[model samples]
Target: AQTVTQSQPEMSVQEAETVTLSCTYDTSESDYYLFWYKQPPSRQMILVIRQEAYKQQNATENRFSVNFQKAAKSFSLKISDSQLGDAAMYFCAYRGFYGGSQGNLIFGKGTKLSVKP
Candidate 1:
């Protein structure tokens, strides 16, 4: 069984600053994918970033990036130059590359991020 954990239940970031959200996971599978999904007030889960277990390079998207430490099973998201629109509930997720639930995303409880002006 695989599980994702977000230690910080809530976070607040001032506008124009950077915020890093912590995440860790436990899994026996060697080949898998980690993801950071953002759900705003509208409740739409948007893909923030993704990292493949085999890839040494961390994944990045615009102001969003991930620090994926495969050996320690840590995957954290860093949001740079945070904005009010970036305020949302961020979830860390996992999916095995090949398995019965290959495409099914197993998510963490989530960390709610509040942006302050």
Candidate 2:
């Protein structure tokens, strides 16, 4: 069984600053994918970034990057140069590369982010 955990229920950041959102997971499988998804008030799950378990380098997408600690099972998201549009509910998810339900994503409870001017 796999589970994702987002300890912070909510976080706030200034419009031009940077913020890091914490996330951790427990899993027995060796091959999998870790993702950070953002859902704005509209409730659409958008993939922010993803990291493969076997990849040593963390995944990055423009201003969005991940700090993937494989040995400790920690995957945190870093939002650089935060903007008002980045305010949303962020979820950390996991999907095994091989399993009975390979494509099913196990999601965290989510951390709501608010941007302050």
Candidate 3:
């Protein structure tokens, strides 16, 4: 079984600053995918970014990017130019690509991010 680990229970960043949330996982599968999901107060899960194990280059989307270290089994999310809207709970999720067509997400404990206005 794959397990996601979040070392930080909470994080905070000043508006316009950058913050990185740490995540690590254990998976015996050679192929898999990683995701950073953000859940705001509304409780809707939004995909922040995703990284495929085969992709050597880390994945990035606008203000969000991931530092994926396959050898170390570490995947962290970096939020740059943070904004008040970025305040939410961020979860690192793992899904096996070798599994069924529809894979289920195994989430970390989540890191609560606070953006100081």
User: Model 2, poorest ten-residue lDDT window?
Assistant: 96-105
Clashes of each: 0, 0, 0
Across 26-112, the per-residue lDDT of candidate 3 in tens digits comes to 998878999999999999999989999989999999989999999999999999999999999999999998657327889999999
- Give the per-residue lDDT of model 1 (tens digit) for 30-82: 99999999999999999889999999999999999999999999999999999
Candidate 1 regions with alpha-carbon error over 4 angstroms: none
Superposition TM-score, candidate 3 onto the true structure: 0.96
Per-residue error (Å), model 1, residue 84: 0.4
Q: For candidate 2, lDDT tens digit of each residue in 1-117? A: 788999999999999999999999999888899999999999898989999999999999999999999999999999999999999999999999886786689999999999999
When summed lDDT is taken over every stretch of 10 residues in candidate 3, the lowest stretch is 96-105
CA lDDT of each candidate?
0.95, 0.95, 0.94
| Candidate 1 Cα lDDT to native | 0.95
Give the clashing residue pairs of candidate 3, or none.
none
Compute the lDDT of residue 36 as modeled in candidate 1.
95
Whole-model lDDT, candidate 2? Answer: 0.95
Quote the lDDT for 106 in model 2: 95
RMSD per prediction, one decimal? 0.9, 0.9, 1.4
Q: How does each model score on TM-score? A: 0.97, 0.97, 0.96
